[model samples]
Target: MARLVAVTAVLGLLLAGCVDPHTWPEDQDDIVNGPLEVRTHWQAFTLEQPLQINDEGRQRLHLVLDGEQYESNDLHDPKDYVNQFNPRRVDGVLIEPDIILVGDNGNEVRVHGTGSLGVRTGRLILAFGTHHGDFEDFLSRPPAIPDDIEHFEALRIRSNEPFTIEALHWSVDRHPDLHRCGRRCTWLERWLMGE
Candidate 1:
């Protein structure tokens, strides 16, 4: 009975630590390596559509998801947009600001870009643009993408403000449209076809 009680107590404490009490627009405490919550507002693909395997070769698709974070405190205006932080070069020293992405599985991907980045003091708008590569082995195992859907619910970005690009269950699929040339095209295809 004592052992059972101790185990239960430990489990309870561990679970408590996992809970994040800070809510968006209210919590902006950490500016550097701090947790910022980002909600997915929109997403797009670099290629017009999912790359189809042609000539028995491998295919890859580039995905982009845009997210945003808000600061609704006296320190920041609730209605203002928090831009991403930008690094500067001082005295020939190159300072690079970085943001990290944390997936639902605890895997992390680093975000690198200067788009929508802001200064730490005067700016609050942080724009999150994340890219992922999806590779398909045409010869061995072709991607069985159902109706051309891409699932990215397990992806999130970590920065001064935590950004959730999409919900853990988010999925995106491409549907054929008449005007889109009966199939989506990418720069690769354009180059290959010499168009």
Candidate 2:
């Protein structure tokens, strides 16, 4: 059964990204012109379904932390130098509400950002670029994520789909999974997956 299942997963070709996938679905009405500026975001998501981000969702930065409502100032304050998760800027769209993606293969990833869930082609990808710091900084020392802010425990994205927060990176160490080049996976996610 195990071998059969593994073969099935491979046959599925569980590719998680697309090239030039429309930022918004063709059916979705155009809301902005010439590349909508999605600024002040930190994390991002690969979505499966549609959801809403109302005024409150937007104001709250679209994150639910510690089961409590979390909000983002989107102020991009200098004081937030220690917190990479703080309000930052990225160019993307929120096709839906935030939810983590857990593949059938036990690979998982999460994206935290200004606010949004994503979708494109047949797959959904909501991406907000993270400030991994300059090339030198990344190789030497990735920017700090503030000791005060809780990691895995703090992020709680309500979702109906099966999910996995326990595995920090995707795929078990025994086997390697696909690397999502586009919005499907962020640099941080890829790094974590390797670890």
Candidate 3:
């Protein structure tokens, strides 16, 4: 009976168009819908402090970027840096906000920035471009973010230039039983399916 059941399960998976015998149905589906940016060079930094939960149950923190501290072609000052997160959502799933621009001048400090939660690692990448007058187009776009990271805490902008601000993320282990079929299973399925 055990061997017969195993054969039937393999046949069912094959009929569902499972190309690789090891590829589960859930592997073919992407539940998180968001535009992810890939990056190669970024410096890792430890979280300055542990995450604090707010009354709303959302986590929060602050990342500060001081551009003036870095050597740059232009005179880096704190007021020159500015950024924005364009927020959007689909079917109640919150999409990752876009970091429109990060500049050294003609921009205001944003109270919040983009980030990902449950990430084990975090990074900082520098964007290209020099400072141009507000009338001219010279502000640099936000650096690319890794696909797996999500969650943004607060942003604290001061008089600085050429600095990257990033939030901490926690990496979580994938749940073994939470798949397409849902959470709970019958005793027979649990016993025979090994999940």
Among the numbered candidates, top TM-score falls to: 1
* Candidate 1: Cα lDDT at 108: 43
Give stretches of model 2 more than 4 Å off: 1-71, 76-99, 114-195
RMSD of each: 22.0, 17.9, 20.2
Error of 1 at 157 (Å): 9.5
Which parts of model 1 have CA positions greater than 4 angstroms off? 1-95, 117-195
> TM-score, each model?
0.23, 0.22, 0.17
Clashes of each: 18, 16, 19
Q: After TM-score superposition, what is the CA distance of residue 49 in candidate 2 from its true location, in Å?
A: 4.2
**What is the C-alpha lDDT profile of model 1 across 1-195, one tens digit per residue?**
999897657544433443333321221222222132332332222221222222111121111222223221223322222222222222222223244433333444444332332333433333323322221221232333333223212232323422322211111112111112113455433343334
Evaluated against the true structure, the overall lDDT of model 3 is: 0.26
TM-score of 3: 0.17
Q: Summarize candidate 2's per-residue lDDT along 121-183 as a digit string, tens digits.
A: 322222222223322342232123333332222222443222212112211111112323334
lDDT of 1: 0.28
Where does candidate 2 have its weakest 10-residue lDDT segment? Answer: 166-175
In candidate 1, residue 49 scores what lDDT? Answer: 23
Judge candidate 1 at residue 12 and give its lDDT: 47
